[model samples]
Target chain A: MFLAVTGFAILRLHSLFAVVMLSGVYSLIAAAMFVALDAVDVAFTEAAVGAGISTVLMVGALSLTKQREKIPVHTPLLPMVVVLVTGAALIYGTFDMPNFGDPDAPANRYLVDRYIQESPKEIGIPNIVTSVLASYRGFDTLGEVTVIFTAGVAVLMLIGGARRRRRPDSRAGPEATRE
Target chain B: MTFVLAHLNYWVVVVLMMIGLYIVVSRGNLIKKIVGLNIFQTSVFLLYISLAKVAGGTAPIADERFTVYANPLPHVLILTAIVVGVATTSLGLALVVRIREAYGTIEEDEIDLQDDEE
Candidate 1:
């Protein structure tokens, strides 16, 4: 219900502001769902990331462009077909899934329980999930952070190529006023 | 926690996750795509927090006789994920801004057509 409504808001809206606001609503609901699951910490993070910073950045992006479409739009049929097929395959695969939260599930028998029990002693943190993500899964986290850093660098390179104008008539700079 | 973890809500969250992921994958509008991405990320947060709960555990606060509080680990990990999500969204939006500035279009399909024209 929440997702459907938000998706409708985002997809139906032509205005960038409306789309961004709808996205905020989507995030806020997600955060609430997280809290309902007893994940207070996750809720906090969702609010900060999904509802706050991302919305601001989207609005900023909107400021740089026309909010309304200036060209004819075609429905993306190829991607839609591909996604639908993949989703069907995924649903078929899930028939083999262990029922949700089944105690005898293979995952429960694995290291997650062990980490929850021993992390307090080994890492001495109140949050076992942190110990797993930072200490045990430190290598993966390092990789993730590196990916973010590399992405930031890549974007800088792409957008910062602004000094040498590709064309003399590309007058979209801050100083250029449309008469 | 008792009823929520046991039944109904769990399935709802799962459905919400799938819908979010679907929108993110299927949308062509860059901003709509980002909104979908937010939904996808939040669904994972729900999954993590749900898994972090203990059946009869207390909240993880320093109180006497409440040694077996629900694990605080999921919360901390989610906090980090949240920060990462925010940064990614902002970067995505910033890229959209630059794309608009350079190409004067925001729709992915339109941008591709423009590239073909060039």
Candidate 2:
């Protein structure tokens, strides 16, 4: 119910500011849903990243652009049709997926058992999620961190570098004056 | 009826995904499109977490008493994905900021029109 309402609100709203606020609300609701699904770590990260960091970054971006969306000129029919067809195909695909919480599901059959049985001894961590994320998948986690680092660099280059070179003469400078 | 109820979460996920896709496709505002992309990514996150669940099992914590643990692999994978999502979103937004500075408008049609004139 919350998800439906939030998704609809995001669709209906045109004010970019209000939409960003609603997206934060959506993320919080999603974090709560994650908690219900027994993914505490995921919930924590979602709350921090989705609700916190992204909202802040979005507001920062919003400050640099128009606050309201201009009315769309083109008809939305084509996009609606495309979305409907794609959604229908995804629903059809889901029919073959194993039922919720089926222990014998293919995803749970092989490596999961070993992780459950031996992670405690192998990694000496009580939380198997952390153990798997940090130890068993250390290389993957490193790559993820690298991705984040690269993103930071990219954002800095895109937003920061431009401001620096755009105005070299002013004493007050562009950054301090813009804000 | 049983089949529908059994996969209710998936259906909800699908609904959310379509909504996101619609926003991305129809909205002219770049920031709104990014918001939609976030919603779409989130629905995928829910799908993965839902699949990782095991009936009557606790979180994947190693302990003597609890034998059944939800699959930890999906949780691990989604954690990485969520981080990646944030990175992509921020980068996209930064690009939007730059677009506004260069073109003097964030609306897609307006930017295209400005480009045509130049």
The candidate that achieves the highest TM-score relative to the unseen native structure? 2
Which residue pairs clash within candidate 1?
A128-B73, A129-B73
Give the per-residue Cα lDDT of candidate 1 at B14.
54
Candidate 2's TM-score: 0.96
Can you write out model 1's per-residue Cα lDDT over B59-105, one digit (the tens) per residue?
44433455555556566667667777776776777677667667777
**lDDT of each residue in A44-134, candidate 2, tens digit only:** 9999999999999999888777799988888999999999999999999999999988899999897999999999999888999999999
- What DockQ do you compute for every candidate structure? 0.34, 0.76
The global C-alpha lDDT for each of the candidates, from Candidate 1 onward, is: 0.65, 0.91
Query: What CA RMSD would you report for each candidate?
Result: 4.4, 2.1
How displaced is residue B109 in candidate 2, in Å?
0.3
* lDDT winner: 2
Tens digits of per-residue lDDT, candidate 1, A1-179, equal 67557766665566768878888888888778666655666666677767887777777667666676433355657656765676566555554555444545554455555665677788887665567678887886787788678767766665566434446677464424432
Runs of candidate 2 with Cα error greater than 4 angstroms are A167-179
